[model samples]
Target: MNVIEMKTPKFLVGIETRTQNSLEIKGEGKIPALWNQFFNFFKIDKKISSDIYAIYSNYESDENGQYDYFIGYEIANPDKYLNGDSYVVKQIEVGTYSVISPINKISENVAYSTWQKIWRMNAKQLGGERLFHTDFEVYTNDKKNGQQSLVNIYLSLKK
Candidate 1:
């Protein structure tokens, strides 16, 4: 559980979709896979080739148990995302986010566990159900000692 607290001035939205209690979120675009393949082929640092993302879910809960619609985004290098021929790329509004550190790429268990910790510790301080705008897990293709090569978790906050 390698954890780091980061604040990005702005990050572009990547993907938007729905998710449940699943721990690991799978790859949905070719760019992400391509980036991973490129790094592995070159045996280089697990860095994203471009900015890539997938909106994971739309429904989020508030403090009062009310439902709010939100979108998710996966962050990656902008250059890699532009060069990939795998999926259609779209530009979205960028916003500040409280970013989490990379986790062990073990079945996305790191993502689920990080979220639980965030909800338990920071949820109260963040805001209401509207605060659940969206959450995303960023990944790069690298297997270090069978651990995750590149990845980050981001949560959209009310700012």
Candidate 2:
């Protein structure tokens, strides 16, 4: 894990939907379907590039509460994506973040397990209090020969 500061705000252009962890566990997740829509919209996959950004924002409360989740690419321009109705644009404000690459070979179970640890973590364990503002997951397309997923999670922290 590494701690880093985002000196400037970043923008993402993609699709978004609201979801909660508790709802997801109850087989009521909208994220999986949202990803499908993303793939259809972007038409790019691991065979091409898995370099995508998953943004978690608009937190209603903590981890258990509903939040807006977005999956898209970092971009300098938002205007190009504005023409589409399915597309949503977001700006991530400057903040300190803890970067954790929980696993090399990512699976659904392991990824959630990593988050379980984070949810249980307090300020001391996390090295700082959480901002809960704009946590994100970076999906890297580095895996070659196969489609093994990657979990490079970024959690927002206090300055």
lDDT top scorer: 2
Instruction: Return the lDDT, model 1, position 49.
Output: 51
Candidate 1 has a TM-score of 0.44
TM-score of each: 0.44, 0.86
Residue 38 lDDT (model 2): 82
lDDT of 2 at 148: 67
* Model 1, residue 126: C-alpha shift (Å): 6.3
Candidate 2 residue pairs that clash: none
Worst 10 residues of 2 by lDDT: 41-50
Of the candidates shown, which would achieve the greatest TM-score relative to the real structure? 2
Cα RMSDs, all models: 8.3, 3.1
Candidate 2: C-alpha RMSD after superposition = 3.1
